[model samples]
Target: MGKKEKSYALGVDVGGSHITVGVVDLVSRTIDQKRLERHPVDSKGSLTEILEAWAGAIEPFCQHEVLSTVQIGIAMPGPFDYDAGISFIDSTQDKYESLYRKNVKDLLAKKLGVSNAQVRFKNDAACFLQGEVFAGIAKGYKRAIGMTLGTGAGTAYYHGTEAHDAARWGEEYGDSIAEEYFSTRWFAKKYQEATGKELSGVRELVDMKEESWVQAIFKEFGQNLGKFLVKFASEENAEIIVLGGSIAHSSALFLPETEQVLSRSLPGVPIKKSILGEESALIGAASCWYEA
Candidate 1:
């Protein structure tokens, strides 16, 4: 008998500043790392520029003969109509404002020389968690909350079978919404407020770890995160929590405090960092075509 042919799908992860595309092996639920492509994008660009950037990253994969017939699954940021392939993102958000009310599926399909049916979309946050749940750290857990703390805050809920966007970024929290408190902007804002100096992001802040103020800042962040998770996890009955994205790389600085706070209430709930990193979203996005 001949060896079975491996099934593949195209996965795309669209971020505020970049887009990543890869070929995913469905049976193994992993990305073909060698074939990965990434490109920087100006989210503030005109509608045509943004679409071209996304389509450009994805076009090469589709051109490969073996992948020509494969479906394309995209992990896109919200406010988007995932089912209809329309974008509702607006100027209020710093990214992808030009896509407001645009039919992205049709646009990308035309650009790629494919039909709209060949493309599918899922919330980026949900795709991150779904990738984790499908093959990463949360694989065995029945209920999990996946968080990506970076330039913005992303939340997703996995209900064992599938994951969905938690969409809690705008939910009320301390002085503002959860996004204000949990994102990179918050870290920069807090640091500037305390020292009257500018901070690029968490990476720069991490370098100043020896400073008492930096230590205090991380501890406070942990406390706030833990408190917020307590309520979210309790409501979702989350069995495990997986953290990813840029801020999560510095988790060691804040995880201890977060654990301390969780121990008081949601003790025994495992909190883990993503093992797959950026590939989580890629695999998750491609998995959308796994059953097809």
Candidate 2:
């Protein structure tokens, strides 16, 4: 009898300033935390430079001569065509300017010496929820909402069996998006507006949770987040909401108020923090193929 072939998938998480890749075991739907490869990318650099850096980060996981039947799934940020694999981010963003209107799938496949068909792209936010639905907190939930609270509010909804992008819903907020009030930038901005002290990010503000002003800031943030959720929960019919990303790490600072608000308004829906942490994206990226 022929030897049973091993199945694996290369999952890549491409962020604004970094790229992380992993080799996920198909059957297990998980990646080795130790074997995961991460590298910083200069989004402001030339497209060739960024692509090369992404390829380089992934190469370490593909060192073996052959990865028979291995598939590639990339959790990519949007404002682009996911099906066409094109990037729409422009110079105005101060990042990925060189890749504006570029066919990312083909170019990335070429850089990695893989057939274009072997690569698939999905919104990073959807992948985040997908990862959670596959093996994290939402594993058994029939429906759920997921958000990444970082530079922006990356949102997704999982229904039936797949995660779908719900980021567009953020547009309802204002000229910018819901992210304007739901992200770390919002936290920083609110903090500075009140204290007149500039902060690099939410971590600094979280560290000062002991201060009454900081506590009030987070409480208000939680209330804002809860209000946002109330608007979407009914439309999404989500049974639970899970939060990930840099800001979510400080859930203790804000979750109490968030839960209180939800309990009063939305009621039954549960709000939880991501259990998989960083690995969720990698696993979720790989799940793109697994679920297909």
Candidate 3:
């Protein structure tokens, strides 16, 4: 008799603000019991505690008997030594000690008892873009760029499931091309300075009830987003650009302005909002394991 096909594997996404965990069934082409768990970055929690939260949130799915392999994918913030699967850089969460070292991948795999399993780690933006391609707005498009407009902006290029050996990916050094001066955080900073309102995140800044109040912020964001896309278009010559983030989801607030600006600057290349919400990373992580 032929060997039975493996069941499902779990995919986990760890962002600066939250974590998402899901189970993906390959043959069925469906996601099961996807969960979004929020965890803030803090100068607290030991390495074990942090990981326990990550593992524990996703553990329920692994208990399913049909899963042949416990595949785990992590979409982390930047500057990781992906080849070594290590996050050498420390997060703001460093208390008296840092959480991880050279063997984070090893540690995670061991803790999960996934010694023989596949564990992949890459920039969160790349995973976000991958999610865009897998289930978000960029599906079927071979060449595309995905920009995550969040606390900091991040961009990654992908040609379908494969990334074209990125010459530059998002990093703190300036967010490089992702540094759209008009990001929501940028707007909050400028709005707070210009309007004198202490706002939480950009979400409050773009409440949309007051269009005129937010017009300048949206306009500036459009200009910057447009300019950056033009540069990317010149380089990657991509056909589409996808955006995924909380800020991106509020397309009602700023996307029209963004579209108008890109239309003027980027002629043929099109810009689109992310269909996959915050769950994009979770979906992307699941795609990673399901594809392999």
Candidate 4:
């Protein structure tokens, strides 16, 4: 008998500032690290320009002789119709405004010289959590939740083979969405208030760990994260929660305080930081095809 042919999928993660493309092994739930590629995107570019850039980034994978049969799966940021693959991004944001209401799947497929039916899309948050559950930190959990904390907070809940956004529950902190408090801007604002100086981001604040104000900021951030976790856990009945994204690098600073908050109401739940780092979404995107 002949050896079984290896099946692969092209996983693309489209973010506000960057796009990453890679080939993943559908059966193994792992990405081919050597084939991973990244390209910066002008979020403010015109419709044609943005699509061209994305297509250019993905073209190599499609044309690779070894990967010629690979399917495409995109983890795209929303407000989008994943089923129809149309973008709903508004002009209020500088990123992807030109793509508003565009049929992204068809556009990209045409550029790749493939049929639109070969491509699939999913919410970036959903992809993030699904990746973790499939092969990252939340692998064995039956009910899991995940968060990606960066410019904004991204959340998703997972069960069995799929993941979804945490349904909103009228809970608001400081009169705004939960993300407003759990994101980088919150750290920046709090830092400026305490030290009377401007800092670029959470990384800078973390670097100044010697400063009393910096420690205080992370402590408060942890407590806030705990509160948000409690809300999600209560609603979703989550068994484990995993944290990812750039800010998670500072886990040492805030995780203790976060645990302090969760212990108050739900000590039994496990909270873990993502081990796959940036690759979670890439793997998750590929899983969309294999898991389906």
Backbone atom clashes (below 3 Å) for every candidate: 0, 0, 0, 0
Off by over 4 Å in 2: 1-6, 65-68, 174-176
Local accuracy by lDDT, each model: 0.90, 0.83, 0.65, 0.84
Q: What is the lDDT of residue 113 in candidate 1?
A: 87
lDDT of 3 by residue, 229-248 (tens): 67776688788988877677
Tally clashes: model 4: 0
lDDT ranking from best candidate downward: 1, 4, 2, 3
Least accurate 10 contiguous residues by lDDT in model 1: 1-10
Give one digit per residue, the lDDT tens place, for model 1 in 24-110: 988877888799989999999999999999988988888785434658999999999999999999998889999999999999999
Looking at model 1, how many pairs of residues clash? 0
lDDT of 4 by residue, 173-214 (tens): 757877778788788788778878787888898789998877
